[model samples]
Target: MSISERISALVGPASFVVAGGLSVAVAIFAAITIERRTIEDVETVLAADGIDWVLVSANGLQVFLDGTAPNEVARFRAQTGASAIIDPDRVINRLDVAAADTAAPPRFSLDLLRNGDGIQLIGLIPGPGGDEAFAIAEAIADIAGEAEVVNMIESAELAAPETWDAALAYGLRALETLPRSKVTVFADRVEVEAVGETREQRAEFIAQLQQDQPEGVEVVLDISAPRPVITPFTLRFVRDAEGGRFETCTADTAPARDRIVAAGLAAGATGVIPCTIGLGVPSPSWGEAVETALEALARLGQGTVTFSDADVTLIAAQGTAQVDFDTVVGELDADLPDVFSLQAILPEPETLASTGPARFTATFDAEDGARLRGRLPPGSIGQSVQTYASALFGADATDIATREVADLPQGWSVRVMAGLTALSELNDGQLVVEPDLLRLTGNTGDTELVSRLTRLLTEELGPGENYDLDVRYVEALDPVASQPTPEQCESRIRAIQEETKITFDPGSTEINDTAGEVLDAIAEVLPDCLHVRMEIGGHTDAQGGEGMNLNLSQRRADAVLNGLLARGVLVTNLTAQGYGESQPIASNDDEDGREQNRRIEFRLLASAEVAAAAGDIDDQPRTRGGILAQGEIADWPFEIRPLPRPINPDGE
Candidate 1:
């Protein structure tokens, strides 16, 4: 303020007088310069540049460029031209260009996929006028959850059709009906892919989708429903001090599965759940079989029934009474349909044997109602075993078939006592053990006994112990083993052959129809004799040359073997040989004697295990009764007859 006031006072009147004089002088000079420049080039420059839109005027030392230029460039040129005629700094230019007259092309598309989790959207769409696109996206985000939305749509410049809103609403409604689906929407068409849990659901989804399609729009739909697959239908249940529990459970149908679960509940099994339903079941009876098996298993109190299709395995708890085990196994075997196969295991003392070198044995008879023959350690240990068996089997029934032994491994007494206790539980079966392993074989329907004993042994014996289980759990032991191991098998076969000779056709190897039927009896015994081998030897009278007779005898023997095989006999242990006329049982001089000499005989051969089970017969070589032999045939199971005289080749 001070500086400005001082300067104003100093130059106020003098500056006014000097400015007026200078203005007059400048004005006079500018008028003269304008007059000369205007006349020289201003009008001539406008005509030469064709710049009619521009006008120029002079005012002393400043130049004014007026009028509208055609464009910015024209305006700039006008300014430069005026500046060229006068001073550059004194010129000013003004201009305005026209507004643009075009807009961009259109793009529109949208896709949506929805599942149990949520929904996703993708592709282009017309931009909603006034932020409607944002509002729509926000609405979808709210419905499907923001995390699930995938908005990849690009709005088109063209306005959306009047029906676009209606189509979007229809598609979304259709999507609601199909949680698992993918939907695509075009201006006039809706395409969908969907899944349903069952046929009805799939049908309903498709119907709803088609009905909701926008008016005058095409609807494309793909829907499917499929059942699940269970790799191996499996089930395992057991009971112990902790009660019952299931390792795994599965079923093919609802009803059977329900029954299995119900049985488990009845037995107090924990963690029950519905079995998965599928089409991969072995048969319609699959459910019933499993359910019935479970019930049987439950009745036994402890056991595991593992079923994969029709192959069923039952493992009974140790010490299960032999009668009960046999009854159950036999009953199940008879009751179960032909489609199923049953295998039962009863593990006893060996189940709890010491890992080191040792020997032990135990016996039980549910039928005789007692525990019998067994081997135990000496002194207090042996007394303890005897005492334990007496308690479990009752003193009267406990016929202790035992002897004292020394050098038993540690824990031998405990294992022996445990073994006896386990034996007491069986109906009837004996167990033997050595440094190698222990084995239990008996009959019982009781599942609980096996399950309990199995658990007990696994816990006490350690995992390394071995078991050679021969226990069977059916209504009966073995029908074949039960009826006649000696008579019905080998003895019966020989009896048939003796009562009725199996004759052949002259010198031919063919057996007579009557002979074939007799051989069928021998076939029946072959399987039971899995323990032994049978030899069918053929003989011939001295009517022909030795070579021919020998050949004939061999052929007849071969015929017998083949006939046995044809009748379903397992001939694995059978052989055929020809003695020809060499080993004659009767004089070859007479027809009657010759006929007797030309006969077929059955002989027994014993394998190692069979020899052990067969007693004295293993050491003795024996031939069928009334035939040539080194020793008499033991009263074993096989039975066969001599072949009658064959009709002459000339058809006598």
Candidate 2:
């Protein structure tokens, strides 16, 4: 082809090539657009069904699901369902439904006021369904794109009571008020505005209102009137000091008030305040008088005078005169010669009764009178002598003495006889006359008579040189004999056994049946007593280990205790003790000796009454032989043979 023809032809072929390229480009664009549209449609459908997904890729009319659906089955159904509208071969299921679900944004519902990007929710969720609100909000944000949530869901709380009774019973207590008939409650802003009389009633209303308020709600009380004051009580007594007619004081204050006034001071108090003086009756002067008389009697080396009821009355008599001429005359006879005379002119009975005074005149022979006058001092004459005589004759006077005369011995003898007669008269016809017997015999120069009289008098009188001469009396002692009653014998046996450390068998633990026979004998003798406490002790020898022996002893003791219990002995009254090698009555060196040492002892634990019933028998044996001697055993009226050992091992 020529240059021009060639250029045109090349242009034509180039144009055709360019057109084919344009067509191919347009077709590819249309396919891409269709796939994209299909994916958008599938997503829309999923969104309406509360499902979410992602468009992974699009190949011609085919589509792939990349995001999660509500469930695995739902995801498969979504993919397959989308393929039905598109092409399955182009759809790649590389999406992990579980992973996608974990990564997916939560769905929510929003009944909100959205201004641009802000959201404000308002609605009741019923029954504290706050979790539902959060879920709905999140879901709405996920579906409609992210947004801010101004959550206004309230916490669940109980409804408030509208009535007073229901409110009062709602766990709220009034300060110091009880619910009453007229109480009422009105709640405003979770507060009580009370309108009522009676402070207690108002308080109840306020409390009931407060009771109905929810937590975090402020309560305000608007009471119309002031609450009544609860005043404390004052204990008032009816007293003159309080301008009352009746006089009164605290009962306990009487003692202190009286004490203050009794100290010789006017207590500062008004009204009739009763007084109690603690002054007691004076001690008897009779005790001092008796003590003085006892001292005087002691000085006289005579028998003591004990004042009985009868003696006290007689001595205390106001106008009574006691003619103690025996004491007076005995004193005179002791000081004077063998012969003396006493002219006792006691005051007349009527005069003594009126004046309560005593007068006595003792006369002596001329020589005796001279001796008496010589013994008197120069100023002791007439009135002085008479005063001395009056003192000797006074009611309180016990004795008197006069000098004896050596000259005119015959008159002295006569005076001595008169003194004896006077002594007999004062003695109330009960004079001992022992000293007189000695004096008379001494003057006669009869050694035998003096000795005999002295011995006789000393034997009859006690360790005294004088006698009371009040009256002669003889007393015969009546011995008390107590026979053993059954109760008494039982008590004695129990006491003896307890004190003596007596006991019974070990392992076999029972009191020997023979012991029962002994007890039966005792019971036969004495029958009234009933209750008894017996202590059975088990002792072991030193042949075994101390711990083992101790346990063995205890078991043995328990065995005996059980035996006693089986025998109808009260469990409370029976006590068992284990003394492992502690108490040994015999040597523990040899087998036989050890056997003897391993023994049980029964002891009677007697009470005081039972011990008292044991009588006067000496519980201690005279000697060790007495305890071990066969004669002593034979002397027991009842024979006690040893009980037979049980045959079977378990019978114990």
Q: Residues 1-652, candidate 2: write the lDDT tens digits.
A: 7999989989998999999999999999998888778777777765665565555566665566776555678777776666665557767775555644454322211123444454455543322345334433443343223546575744233332233212221111121122111222222122233345664456435533443243332445564434332111000111112221101111113343344223212212344433322122122222232233323233332222222211210111112234453453344334432222222222233443443211122432212221122122223333354354444334233233433223322222323233233332221221212211212210222112222232233233321222222112112211111233323544565564444332455444455765445434433422222223444566788875665665667667776556545555445644565556656777888888887777655544322112212221122112211211211111110111111111221222
Per-residue alpha-carbon lDDT of model 1 for 1-652, expressed as tens digits? 6998988898989988999999999988889887667634765776688877666665655666677665667777776777677667876554454444456544355688887677788877765463435745644653464347666666765676655554555555556556677877766676777889985578656654553345655667888776566544445565655776654566666687787788777766766354556666777777677767777777776766666656777777767877788888888877777688888766554444435445566666665765445456889868877887788878887676677778766666665565555566667888776554556677765533464455354445543344344555565553422444432455666777789876787878897888877887766667766544566777888998766786688789899988888888777767676656766778989999988887887765322112222232222222112121211223222222222222233322
Q: Which ten residues in a row have the lowest lDDT in candidate 2?
A: 230-239
Clashes of 1: 55
Q: What RMSD does model 2 have?
A: 40.4
User: Which candidate has the highest lDDT of all?
Assistant: 1
Give TM per candidate.
Answer: 0.26, 0.19
User: What is the Å distance of residue 243 in model 1 from its true position?
Assistant: 1.9
